[model samples]
Target: MTVLKKLPIVSAVFRKVWLQIAVLLVILIGNILLDLMPAQKEDIHGYTLYKRWAAFLGIFAVTWILVRVVSVLRASSVMGSRLAPNISALLFTSLRILIFVLGSLIALDSIGISITPLLASLGVGSIAVGLALQDTLSNLFSGFYLYVDRPIAAGDWVRLENGMEGQVGRIGWRSTHLLSSENTVIIPNSKLSNSSVLNFNLPFPTASFNLVFSVSYQADLDRVEDTVRAAAESALRDKSDLSAGTAPIIRFTKFNETSVELTLILKARSFPDQSELRHEVIKRIRKAFRQEENLGLDPQRIFRLVSNQSDLV
Candidate 1:
């Protein structure tokens, strides 16, 4: 019974292997036939037109097979899965184009065409084009760097030094797409390369959140601290989004004229959980302050009377 169940799986595997072998054999046989075929007429360079055509076809077949092999390698996990699908496809397409262009030049040379002058002209023309599209090339190169270095990947919450914070949607040749709030922001890759980016999703998803509050200056500092700490503990008790492993920290930051400034630091599971966690913590603290008589947090105001300028003169 087990053999019957595994029979289809084995057959499918065998069929896939056979198909790949058959494709390779076909490409090999085609190239062999092209080499053996006789030339019809000779060109000015002593090479035949038929041979040139055959060479072009052979080059194309070889490039196709190489591309297929690369795809197979990617599928087999030979090339690590760090690259996104779109980036991988783009790289492979670029490789195919480069191979085709080089092959075409060779085929043309095999005919009556001189490649020396063509190569020289292409070099000069490429320099002129490069100067004209300097910014574009910069972005393209920066995009390539981003992909290779992988400081930030798709779906990561990132904040740029310029204060553009969002979730990365896609990384393209020219720009990166970011989803910020309700809008989609397109930032040039060059800008991204130059700017400092903070990736919150990397290393770990846990993020530290700091909340500052002030209590009445008349309240006892130790009592205030203990009450706030108890409130924070109660807030984080049942919340799964708050990291329970790290204990909440409380510190008296400053002494104001009417209030004492206190800072509370805690950990949230991720960036998205920060807002809700903060809200819950604040609500709990506010309730605790109202219920406890010694934990008053109302600000006090003192007024001073000033004489008019004419009276001073």
Candidate 2:
């Protein structure tokens, strides 16, 4: 039954592939025929006009085939698996334009048109244009590197070293779009490439949340650990955002003059889930502490004793 339902999609894909192959074959045959045609006696710029026209046609046909082949390869999983879809499409487009330009230049040169002056002028103009658009080009190349290196991708939750964190909306030519909690942040690709990025979605969707708090030194250590563990377990069981496979961990990290600092490490399904999971865990732990005997004092408050000197004065 499932096979029958998917048959139409498979057949459609096969049909499209066959059509592309037929077009490519036609282009090749046309190029072959153009090569076989006789050159006329009429000359343009010391070259046979018929030969020039035929060469131009042949170049166009070959360029068309190259573009078509690349487009087909890019559309298949073979290329798409290695590169992001957007990046792959961009590369294919640039490849097509490059092939077309080179072919056109070759055809023009074949017709006895001197390309030396044109090449020199293009070189000078390109340098000037490149200088004017230095920043833009930097971003463009950075964006290309980001797509190739793949430090982060669309829909991945990432945090920059500067404390900006969000889910990536898109990776553009000049900038990367991030959909943060309050607004969208447009970060230049060059800056992103230079900065340190923490991708929470990489390797896996599960993320760990660390919650630090201090307990009074007077409190029982074993009881505190048990209470915190129970609270975390309750949070995991009651909240849908928390990961059920990994158990909550409690660690005694530091001992201050007044209190013992502890950390509660919990697992969430994703970065966004951390907030809710932390909230629920903190609430549960606070409630548990309040209900327990002799464990609800503020850990930050310090007590001081001063001797009275008024009698001596």
Candidate 3:
């Protein structure tokens, strides 16, 4: 019954790779038959056939195992982090590629390929290419280090050193794609490695906003403060879409010659929509002030001068 239950599970997995399994089985059966044939009595070259089969099977098995191990490690719950998936994928892919390259070299060596000349030629070629494409190679290695460090991940909201802000879309071998507020930005991995990246999402889910505006100097100071605070409080009062418990603040920042500059700080549930929230606050304040009469005074004061002749009369 246990075996029967597993039959369904086996069937499901095999269904995806039925063709590969069929080919491997055929090769295995043929190799077995060649092995069983007598050395002197066989009509075909059984030894050569067995050697080719062994080489092919060994390489295939190694590649398959490496890929499977990578898949398992990536899906494991033990690795927990936003960047874990991308980091794991990069690490696993690099490991497998290295393993396959080394394995291929060994397999070629076993098959009587001269490795000494190959190594010497590759070394010289590597030096030449390294010098020619130093920047590109630097970025490539920097990307690898970034992957290992696990500082950023796809979908993370980050601020670049140059004042660019965006959510990471993809991490490629050469460049990292950013879905910025303005458009899609592609940053070379090399450039990113050296700079400071501020990951806002990792530290906090909610982002705060400070809206600054100026009102006429003649406006009632208390009413001006009240109006701005009332608008923010009312807009944030329902708190349906926005995150709760964020205190709304309104304060007079500085007194100017013609107007008073005020600062209003509020929390936004979504960081990327801060502009929208600012616009909403401005709109609400304008509408609220418009509804009330003489709430804010005009600060433009006019002065009249008397002539010297009028003073003498």
Candidate 4:
């Protein structure tokens, strides 16, 4: 009773299920010790044998209970429920399996059971499983590396090698799920691990985009520049979703066959918004240029057609 009073509660619970096993082990040990006792007392076929076996069983039960007490504390410290409830079952099951395997091996050895054959069989099975899941293992390891390195995460807008632009929806162990404007794409972790990935939503959320606006050569260069600048400023000011930072840049880049090429650079929240902003700014600039008569026809229409002497014939 005093021993029970000092015993751990966790160990007491486990002993309920393992008490019989502990009894069997104790009996085996006591029988061997009895054979070494004095010749008269060593009579293994009497009530003395039962008494000795009972004492052994008691010791075995107490020891097993102590071990379970330690296991409970260890398991509590590493409980998956503290991290995530959904994964708690997996964590607990794995821990219990480990405890069972180790405890069984130790208990078996105490009872004189050989473990070499069991270990050899386990090793062979492990090798076979490794060979069968080589590719899956690679992807699993790669996924762990990716999570640790964190090159990309969920909600990041990325551009894949295949020219597909999408937001990373999830980082799965075997595949990365992406949600694009057109559809959802599943990219294998193997491919993502080896290929290039462009994550646009990291370091900063906004980026610069370019818009090319070609004007007729006959148009007034000065007025076109001012008009384009106003259009760009208006576009940025009108959007409540876009963040304000640098001013829009309007520059004359080159002279083409029939028009003057002007480039407008502006910052956008993301790739999708960039295209919309560019189109809005261009539309405004074209409207403003058309309203003002000073901005004349494009060079493509203003060119004079000349014929050679062969046309006179």
Candidate 5:
């Protein structure tokens, strides 16, 4: 059709939603009124074929309206944190497909179409498609689970069970992108979903973790506590990268083979946000302990610390 001829048809279908509703209403109302007019079947095919078609058209219109509402919600819900906006988008699209399928089936059935053959063909086709794309579909559904369970999100620092640790770049339909210090890691959603992931940036950004250090056996316990606590408090107050949590506290936990172990609770703004912060805190504490000769390490520098409780930290 030429532009001029298409204008009327386009306006009727693509105008505001209320116009579509009005059109559907007119079709339904006119069909009802026609049925009541008591025309003989021999007079017009309008009594059978056309009437069924009109009812089918009405059903399809309502289906379109419902899918439109879902589309609007999907667009407006983009700002939901951690729920992966694209995942919501996929969800709405799936819902729209489902509505279209059901509406088409209902409309066809209303017009005396047999659905048995259609259903059998669909079942066979779906099985073939599923078998061919097993891995792809597995990843897709796993992405859906990630959206619902919310194990991680963009910008989170996560360590996967397979030993890939990084900031999440994005969670895509087929895979998740993670940017580490070394490289960007792309994980298939299926593996990520099944494996354990350690999220370092949850509940609070600046959460506390234990830092352990060893001191000489002869060090004064009382003075040691005061010195350590003073160092921790000073580091937290003066450092911008540290302390979004409780004030630092020191605890004399155990006696090791050669030295006394003390645990200091330290906070960070975010996981791996700064290696410099750890270095800075240790440097400050070491400088402070230099004045207190008794708090020095047995044979080496005083600040022999472990990070967040790995072996050497």
Candidate 6:
């Protein structure tokens, strides 16, 4: 189906699973034939070398098959899980190396080569290396857990327990990158795994905010609510993507010095949409109130824009 498969040599190798089985059977039979064939004293050394070569080839075949299986699993399982491509690749490579290493050791043992000393040294070295790279190993394992658990993902806004808040950018083997306030923040995976995180884009990304505005005491409460509701409803109808599929909530609060306070609770599909949604709703409502001068919006009072980051509901 691909250009690589269209090649003469490549196509032959991938022709059929039975073809690979046939090659494996040939390798096994060749080893058995080596033992069955009659040999003189002068040819014994050559036969020993041939047997070692055959053993190596057997190991190579097994490793090759295992690596291909790993590749298939990586493509289907890892990629399908929506894991970071580089992390999946790293895991695939690690599995391949483990297979090849075990295969090579088995091949050596088969040829009467002792691997005990090598394994012993490797064990001691691994302990030392593990101790030295303690933090790195912790981050690596934490990263693996983070990827599998999927608590955070790219483009999701997350607030960490330690006052760190941002949108997730990229997750790596060592660190989770965050984009905050136009800056890239690199936090270690270990910290993210252990910390309490609030994801704004999960458990339903729809977020609500309250708009507190006051009108002159002379304004009719019933007329004010009706006018503002119509305006906000118009905004929601026009920008469906920003709407949270909920109706606007209009309620009155307390009395002020010369005006009564009213609150307009509105919902946005996501946190980022709050700005545009609020903008559209406020623009429509203000215009509606202006057209209906009887609504008494208190021209002396001005609307001051406040940051919506803390307007989480």
lDDT of 2: 0.74
lDDT measured at residue 3 in model 5 versus the true structure, 0 to 100:
68
Clashes of 6: 0
lDDT of 3 by residue, 1-313 (tens): 5673666534443444455566667777877876687775346755765676577666665555555555444554544343445556766677767777676776676566778887898899989999999988887888877787867878787888898988999887678999976799999999998889987665565677677666665566787677678877777765437633576777777876766677677777666655566566666776666665553343222111111110000
Task: Residues 1-313, candidate 5: write the lDDT tens digits.
Answer: 4663656433333443676698798997887777677558447655777778888888888888777766655544333342456786677789999999988998999899998899999999999999999999999999988877888988898788778888999999999999999899899999999999988777655545667788767667777678778877777777765556457768888888877888876666777744555566677677677766554443254345544452111
Q: What's the CA error at residue 75 for candidate 2, in Å?
A: 4.6
Native-to-model Cα distance after best TM-score fit, residue 250 in candidate 2, in Å: 1.6
- Which has the better TM-score: candidate 2, or candidate 4? 2
Check candidate 3 and list the clashing pairs. Answer: none
- TM-score, each model? 0.69, 0.73, 0.60, 0.62, 0.81, 0.75
TM-score winner, 3 or 4: 4
Ranking by TM-score: 5, 6, 2, 1, 4, 3
Tens digit of per-residue lDDT, candidate 6, span 25-103? 8878977777687766347667767767777776767767776667666766435476578788888889989998898
lDDT of each: 0.71, 0.74, 0.67, 0.65, 0.74, 0.79
* Candidate 5 C-alpha error for residue 217, in Å: 2.3
For 1-313, candidate 4 gives per-residue lDDT tens digits of 5675575554455555466666667677876786677777634467464664455455555555555554464455344234333234434455566656766665555555688898899889989999999888778767766776888888888887778778888877777888988899998888888878877766776767766666677767786677778877877788737623568877888988887777767877765566676667666766665565454544334322121111000
Cα lDDT for residue 17, model 4? 45
Give the poorly placed runs of model 1, Cα more than 4 Å off.
1-64, 74-77, 107-113, 242-245, 254-260, 294-313
Provide the lDDT at 274 for model 5. Answer: 41
Which of the predicted structures, 1 or 2, would earn the higher lDDT when compared with the native? 2
lDDT of 5 at 72: 55
- Point out the higher-scoring one by lDDT: 1 or 3: 1
Give, for candidate 6, the lowest lDDT window spanning 10 residues: 301-310
Candidate 3, residue 129: Cα displacement in angstroms equals 4.1
Runs in model 2 deviating more than 4 A are 1-56, 74-85, 294-313
Q: Which regions of candidate 5 deviate over 4 angstroms? A: 1-15, 38-45, 77-83, 294-313
lDDT measured at residue 16 in model 4 versus the true structure, 0 to 100: 54
